[model samples]
Target: MEKDLKEYITPPIMLIVVLLAISLMFIFPVLNMIILGAILAYGIRPIAFRIQSKLKFSSISILLAMIIVLIPLILLVAYISFIISGFLVGFFSSNPNLDMDSVISQLSTYIPQNPFLDKNSIVPTIQSAGKSVLTYLVGKLGSFANITLDLFILICSVYYFVKDGDNCYNFIKSFVPKEYNDFFERTVESVEDVLKSIFYGHFLTSVIIGIFGAIGYSLLGYPYGIFLGVITGILQLIPIFGPWPIYWALAIMDAIGGNYPRVIVVLLFGFFLSLIDMYIRPAISSHHADIHPLILLIGFLSGPLVYGIVGFIVGPLILGITYAILDSFRKELQESK
Candidate 1:
């Protein structure tokens, strides 16, 4: 009896062990990149296929489609870098004093005169805190090499994912059961739709908002108005809180510079730009995919947490595919029962 029990349990335990070992070997890092690559490929493959049909050559079509997608992204990044460099140079070269001594003097005088007065020690503490913040910023900016390498890795990874996307998807899908091929195909379609909605919808909304923002800022005579507008539009891709911070920062800067009329104009411009999210995102996403906005919102919020920045695209595709597969399986189970 003991021997039989042992024999009965051994194979199943071994199987479990083997599966766990295999998963540990290939799962973590590759999983995120593979998922990201698959969604990107799925979105762009149709365009590549269309180009292929028109040009009657697969390689040329692939190349053209890739170039079309990559060129704008490259140009945008270059422009943003140029703007950032200029801003940094201007800021440091101005040599404007922050008036810390006057602030400390005011605090010391005002607090001592007030009924709430324990100002003796607080003044030194406040000065120390200010100096600590300055020291932190200086230390952070000193690590330029690390920052540059990280950025380079991000760009290269994105490029490689885009270039070899089809192969990546095919490799991952090979794991699905043969009997579940139909379900697998549908899941792939759903994932493709979700990714398309995210990528194209976000891109279209950003461009529209940027155009309106740039026009408004130019009219208001803001220096670097187009750059600020573009920055705001790009930041709109961040979920939960979008471009509000950028607009608010610009408004504050304008206010500090005594351009109150420009502040009002910028605020109104931002208000109009905010409406574009309502009009553009839903229009583009709904046209491509019939996904619930709540689901997309969940994807957008949870994505970065799970997969770093790439998760923003990967999260929704994963949720869509899981929903598709489970729905199909449930239907099948119901029919069988």
Candidate 2:
């Protein structure tokens, strides 16, 4: 036992462990960003390689690939922010002397009156809730510097991961026992499939659905249709939430405003959106690994709570990859037996 302990846990190993612990302490704050970067790199690598073949320069290819993948994402976020701010500014500016009672009375016109329910009382509650939500969002936005730093780190991490992913994989492979080399290779392939499965099944589906939503809403003559579509797409990414919420909310608003015809139209459009997802998701995901919906559901629901917004991407991918590895391990065990 003493000899085994000395052989396995020598001074050098102890020193390495101490160094790793210290390194983790520094990275713990931005670990989520780093993980997200690596995942993004996996998606970007093929694009980088394709670009490299044409550009004949590895660095330029990687940078261009990053831009290709990331620019739309950055623009989407910026556009969403712009729309939200613009809407708020327009609403308040246009209604400088906004009358709460008048608004309530207008709403009450389309709403069925109930003697027990006081519509007037709900106005204060709604105002308080809106204020609280706005304050929370503003407080989050106040951490601009930290957000910038994390983004910088994420970009750097992605660049290196895409550029040197092979080296990283080889380094990790070196640590695996020769007997487990086949297992490691199989696991790697499985993980790749998992990544593909999630990217195509979830993200791509959301994008398609969002496009459908944008066109439908615009055709329906809804203001800010693009923003509504974008929100619908984001909601589609979460298992518990889907295009239903957006259409349902719109329907409710239209109903209250006495636009009953538009409400029915939007509801039908939303149902079409949902129905296509049943076909689109399976078609895109069928070629790759099959990850359980439950795993993704847990990841999507729990990821944001732990890692903030990026968790939406990181959570499901991480869980899917973990599942792949475990499944690979099980196969290896069965083969051995």
Candidate 3:
């Protein structure tokens, strides 16, 4: 045991370990971006290859692919921000003195009159809570430098990952024992499937649902219908939440206002949105492993806490890949036995 320790933890190994630890400390801050970049690279790689097949310039092909994938994402985020900012400005401007009484009175019939419930305080409480949330978001915007750095890292990481992802994979594979090579290959393949499953199944489904929502809401004559659809799409990305909240809120509000016809129409539209998700998600992910919704839920819920907004993507992917690795190991073990 002593000789094994001396051989394993030799001076050179110890030095490498110390340097690696310091390097990790530096990398820790931007780790989320790196992971996100890798995820994006996986999506972008096929496109890059297709472009490369035509253009025959690897670097240019990668840049074009990145542009194709990233531009829409940047635009979507910017549009969402613009819409939200406009909404806030309009809300504050139009309702300088928001009438809590009318809102409460409208809602009074639906809410059971409990002696302990303070009806008048409800709207104010909600307003205050909304303000706090706004403040938190604004505070997040204050970290411009960090956000910029992360963006830079993400772009660079994606570029390199697309350009040299195979090299990295082979480098890691080199460390695996010959006997376990098949296991390693299988695990990697499984991980790739998981990534594709989540991206296509969840993210794409959200986009489709969101678009449907925007069109339906706009035709239904709702204000900020596009914004509502965007929010509905984002909500669909999360497990245990779907497009229900948006329509339910709209339905309840319209019902309170005595627009019962429109309420029924919107509810039916919302149900259609939910029904499509049931179909779309499975159809897209059918070729891949059936990842449990619970795994995704925990990843979505906890990822933001650990890695910020990017965590929403990185968290679930990482967890899904981890699950793949574990399951792969289990299969390998069972086979050996």
Candidate 4:
């Protein structure tokens, strides 16, 4: 039976419209989960495949990969959470040694007197504001349900992305016209390169700095050096201002506590790490994505402000692809002329 052209075109057109409507309905999610999942899938795909070759089971290989990747992440998050909770508990407790009156007096010294505002009233005003914020947040505890749902979605998206990423790519590519397949392929390669450079580049640098920081802190006799180093390494994901503030803050505390020698040592090690950031990151990432560090830095800063945590990854990815696509389009036009 010969189908009419309307029959051939109508289904696909309707399917596309339905998909578009569904996407519009869920657009509030921002698809950060999928983007993150894709990046993770791409990074870990080779390792997963190699493991599968040895094991002769894709499912088991994927399980092993997930364990390898997720366990550490879970541990890190748990550890940070513990540290934060402990700090908060200690801070809020009414320990006799805390001496809040003296602390308030010390804080008061920093506030300059203004003609419009009373110097004595500033601390109470800040305290009132803090209490109001605390109350507001305490009332919002119910919102944790939403955060949990988002995390669940993220985890599931990552799992599926890893499992069916290749199939999904093919499915998407099938929609492209054959005449533009070459351009599409080129764009994919370009985007892939940029993602690898940014994501893997940050990952590699973070591990290096984290390990180095751990070793340095341990040698310098800093307490909980490994934990602090781990945190430091994680913070390296922030560009231009990676982990320096933490080190500086620690050094200031140590100096105040009369550990001048230790402070100097920490500062020197931090400076060395800064050099690695300046040299190694650019050297590795430039081969694939020769973008300015400022682009990434701005992305990290403004991404969180706009799109939340996922913006850190997506911001650079979006900027890189936008440029690459524009360049490819220009080339295609020039060639046609």
Candidate 5:
């Protein structure tokens, strides 16, 4: 009687303790940093294994994985920042010699008037909006210092996650009932497949669209084409808005410049890019994974609403893993039957 009581009481108590601890973990900002590390570790697993195979040193293998994964991201952001900085420097210049009124006067005739449109209204609004953005960015520079510290924490977490990940996995697995261990392992793998599918699938599509945007803009003789293209590419990952604004805005600018034919060409190019995202993304994503495209669409749409930028990843992951667990239960029921 005593042994049975202890057995029944211990599992529930431990489970409750774990759930409480996890709830507490969510209240800390460090959770986001840890999640970021887990994602990087998971995404770089293939590279990490290859490095391990060559070096036979777990620490070196993990370090190489970190560098391989992070350096490209750092370089891309740095390049984009440089481009944006140059654009801002030019935009906010208080050059007394430059004649804004004269420039506005020359371009105003080229703009076709509509029922709600005043010829001079749009350019001044644009100028004012640009100044407002510049002011906002100047105010946000201090927040960037805090972001730098978060980045450092993220890097350290990722390093440990990559190096100690397997050990951590084993430790967690040790907690599972021996009878359910195999099912738990399968569930874990299925969840991992979902994550990899989402990351690589969106990543590939974004890069392709970015290149297309850059090429299309360059052919159309648009200034800062590469910068706009990068922005479009980043936005492509978001489900609700994908390059529509960039292409449409550029098409309007072309129309304003009296280049109607070029406007049509820009629209067509943007349309093609959109179609690639709609069809090609799911094809690559579902190749090895069983997840529906709709799950991803919902994730991309809802994740940012709840978790800010990190929600983009965490939201879908939670949904996918939940599905996997349910499916595993179904499979076990069938087997028992």
Candidate 6:
């Protein structure tokens, strides 16, 4: 009777149970880090191997490789923080009160027929909101000690993962049933492709954008140009509307600073950089794997919603594996039929 009842259970129910069991076993705390580390290790493994071959020692090579990858990231964050702090200090110390009378005078002249000429109330509200935002930012930065510690932990985790990646990969591969080992191996390859393509491609593109932006902004003699450029490049990583916002922001800043020529120059440069994503990303990404652009788009959009920042890496990987597994199952079912 028990056997018959088990047989009667639906395939969907069985699949659900299997998924739950797998998640419970593999999606917990260390598993996520292990998986992340493995993917990272795969991307750097070739370089690590090259270094090892040349240096005749794996440990020193791995350490050097880690430094190569990590130091730039640390420097970028530190530089960005310094620039932001400098900007804030200058802005507050100046304490230049908004010249409402002058603004109203200009507005009255520009729009003679407009009835919304009262600037007193609106100006105060805008000033109040701006101050509030500045205060919030200061409060957040005041907790930098905790933020620094968190960053240290993340760096340590990534370092260890890079150091012990091969063993982790072998451990994961061992769990696959012998009959399905080939499929398991292919899945791992697919994951490596996805990780290398997404992580490295995104990193390279952001850096390029940031470099060009800083150069352009400096040429135009814009204050905090490098800082804004870094921000623009980071924003460009967003799936959609990334570059446009940065361009508009720079244009607005230029307008406020009464630098129309600089505004025009920045706008043109931003337009050029914005359009390069399509060509640049595809070129790098296609070299690794042939994931559908639409799937990648969805993963980029949904990743953060699901797994925070790490979701950007995890979401696409999960989707890729899902596609492979479903394809395999479909073929097997067809063969049985």
By TM-score, the best candidate is 2
Clashing pairs in 4: none
Give the alpha carbon lDDT tens digit for every residue of 1-337 in model 4: 3577667668778898899999877955747766776777776777788898999988778778877888988999899888778877876784747876678778878788877768777778777878999997886686888777777776677667777888999999999999999888888877888787887678788888888888888888877788778888878988756779768988998999999988888898889988888777877787786666677777777877766777877777777777778777887888889
Q: Which runs in model 1 stand beyond 4 Å of their true positions?
A: 1-20, 23-27, 50-64, 96-181, 327-337
Tens digit per residue, CA lDDT, model 5, 69-172: 77988898999989889877887685647787678667767777767867658688657877999998787685897678778888888888877788999998
| Better lDDT candidate (1, 4) | 4
Lowest summed lDDT across 10 adjacent residues in model 4 is found at 27-36
Candidate 3 regions off by >4 Å? 1-7, 92-138
Which candidate has the highest lDDT of all?
A: 2
**TM values, all candidates:** 0.68, 0.89, 0.87, 0.84, 0.79, 0.70
Order the candidates by TM-score, highest first. Answer: 2, 3, 4, 5, 6, 1
lDDT of 3 by residue, 1-337 (tens): 9998888888898999999999999999898889899999999999999999999999999999999998997998999999889988998799989776676657665666667667776667656777899999898799888789889999999999999999999999998999989999999999989988998889889999999999999999999889889999999998778999999999999999999999999999999999989999999998887798889999999999999888889888888999999999999999999
Candidate 3 at residue 211, lDDT?
A: 97
- Ranking the candidates on lDDT from highest down gives 2, 3, 5, 4, 1, 6
What digit string (tens of lDDT, one per residue) describes model 6 on residues 140-251? 7998985676555555666666677767778978877898777677666666676667676776777788778777777777777788778878876766655678778879
lDDT against the true structure, per candidate, is: 0.72, 0.92, 0.91, 0.79, 0.81, 0.72
Candidate 2 regions exceeding 4 Å error are 1-6, 99-135
What's the lDDT for candidate 3?
A: 0.91
> Model 2, range 1-337, lDDT digits (tens) per residue?
8998889998899999999999999999999999998999999999999999999999999999999998998999999999999999999999999997678657656666667657675666556777899999899799899999999999999999999999999999999999999999999999999999998888999999999999999999999999999999999999898899999999999999999999999999999999999999999999999999999999998898999988888888889999999999999999999
TM-score attained by model 4: 0.84
> Global CA lDDT of candidate 2, please?
0.92
lDDT of predicted model 5: 0.81
